[model samples]
Target: MDLNQIRNDFPTLQEEVNGKRLAYFDSGASALKPRVVMDRLAQFYEKEYSNVHRGVHYLSQVSTLAFEDVRGKVQTFLNAAREDEIIFTAGTTESINLIAYSYVLPYLGKSDAILISEMEHHSNIVPWQLIAKMNGMDIKVVPVLDNGALDMQAFDNLLTPDVKFVSITHVSNTLGTVNPVKEIIEKAHANGSKVLVDGAQAAPHMTVDMQELGCDFYVFSAHKVFGPTGVGVLYGKFEVLDQVKPWQGGGDMIETVSFEGTTFNVLPHRLEAGTPNIAGVIGFGEALDYLAKIDVNWRYQHELNLLDYAMKGLKEFPQVRVLGTVPGKAAVICFVIDGVHAHDVGSLMDMNGVSVRVGHHCTEPLMKRFKVPATARASISFYNNKEDIDQWLSVFPKIFKFFG
Candidate 1:
């Protein structure tokens, strides 16, 4: 693969920081948008902008069609069964909250429990806790091994009939560990429980087929996949979604309204309320198209190659302590120096013209599990090449000197 050609597609790659080219490595937080995605957003706003499904003008008709077309694009992207099963939300955080508030919580009772892993982002953990607290349900945590892999034996012990729902991250944002979600789903189904796979970290790196995985629900964010923010996807099986109660009320999601009674709209519309993020969703569609044409297998190999080089180079330093050394992982790496706060490390790296994420990464519990205050992280993507990793590593040994 011509890595330079791929880098050129992103206009941001041309930018210089601190007199050097910007080596962005914070893709786990949010991916840098491609030129196509940004152009699509501008095109929609300039020519085809309108509030969807609420008007009968030229722009509205065009906008509504384009808006709903995105749902179909997303449906095809994830290999979901039908477009009606896809609902657009703010992002992964809202997607999980929707499941907790609208889908799972209604069916759960006092005797029920929700199962989540130790490596989950706060989005997955907090919503379930909120619903569990309100419904008198218990939350069961699956611990992680020293190497940051899930303790599946403990998971087996925790899986019982009482576990009405199992929500776990498909990839850890902090650890880059790709979990055995398909196995988790099958096991949960065997025990008569529904499963929701958080795909925020997984969607950008690999293929996500809802039908093949057999998870009842799946969620991912657009910004993390080279699309715009304020938009994401929540996919549910139609049969299961038919049982969920509506959480929000407005415009297109209502079938009929009365002074005494009201009826909700069908499948996805019932779940989506208010004026939608029309332009963001439209750009998200093009982002999916961008991903479909690329040789993702090559991208995966390239990323893994960069990761291996980064890991090998990082291990040579005495002060650097790597976190999450699972056998199979994504290109992401998290570590901290001996006496530096993660934020300070990140600042020094910034001065060296490399951008990375630092601190707890919204996984305070995972930080607690590892007994660290925080860690500096370099979250890689296909756009990042070996030079980006080398740029990061070049600054690591000098972090203390730069700070001094």
Candidate 2:
């Protein structure tokens, strides 16, 4: 990958923050959009902008084609069996909520249980919690090891015929631990339970094939993959989606509606109710195209290399404590300096022109489990280089002294 060329594509990186060059290290929260993605969005609004799948006019036809084109791209991106299996939703939270409300609520009963892990983000955990509470079902949490990796042995012990569904994150946003999703899915399937892998953190770095992974459902946010916010992808096997009912009701997802009754559309359309984010979806496709051009393995290697470098630097600092030291993890390195609050660390880093994410990272449960208020997260991306790592490392001592 051309690091200089990739960095050049993000115009914001050129600007100075607090009299220093911007060093963005929060790719886990959301990645920086390349010029290609931004330009694609702008071109759509400037040239072909109209409501999709409803009109026969020129712009409408163009917009509809562009929208469906994204489905094809996303289908290829995840290597789904068919384009109809991909459902466009708001984000990972909404996608999981849709599954909970539409599918799980109907299938799960008093004797059923939904299993999740302790390292899951709130997006993956809360929806199931609400669904389990509303229905007569129960929620089970698979324990995490001291190293923050999922306890696969404990998971095996927890699995039973009563487990109706399993929801797990591919890569932890907080701990940076990459779960063994393929093995998890196989075990869940053996017990006749469906599996949903939250790929919000994994999709951006790794190549995900839904067919190969064999998970019943997979979800991720577009913004995290260099696309716009408020857009996401949900991939479910056709047979599974056929069994599940629609979560929302309205415009496009219908075949017939009358005073007495209404019938829904097919696999994907049945789930995508109401008007969609037409422009955002097109931009998402462009982002995927951009990603396709770059070597994914190289990108993964680059990000992981940065993580290792950053981890080594953090280890040399006496006051800093690393969160997790799993063998194979994502580029997310979350830590807390002794005597300094995560918020203060974030603020000081920002002032020093090093952007990093701080706080519980929407994982308050995990924070409470670890007995820390929050941790400052330095997440890397493909575009980042050693200079960005040096920028953050150089400024940490000052932050430690300020809080000390």
Which of the numbered candidates is closest to the native, going by highest TM-score? Answer: 2
Per-residue alpha-carbon lDDT of model 1 for 1-404, expressed as tens digits? Answer: 67898788899888999988799999899998889999999999999998998788999999999999989999988899999999999999999999899888898989999899999999999998888878999999999988989999999999988998999999999998889999999999999999999999999998899999999999999999999999989999999888888978887889999989989899889998899899999999989888888877887888898899998988778788888899889888989888889999988899888999999998998999999999999988999988888898899768857655
**Which stretches of model 2 miss by more than 4 angstroms?**
none
Model 2, TM vs. native: 0.98
**Lowest-scoring 10 consecutive residues by lDDT in candidate 2?**
395-404
CA lDDT for candidate 2: 0.91
TM-scores for all predictions? 0.98, 0.98
Q: Where is model 1 poorest over a 10-residue stretch in terms of lDDT? A: 395-404
The RMSD of every model to the true structure, in order and in angstroms, is: 1.1, 0.9
Clashes of 2: 0
Clashing pairs in 2: none
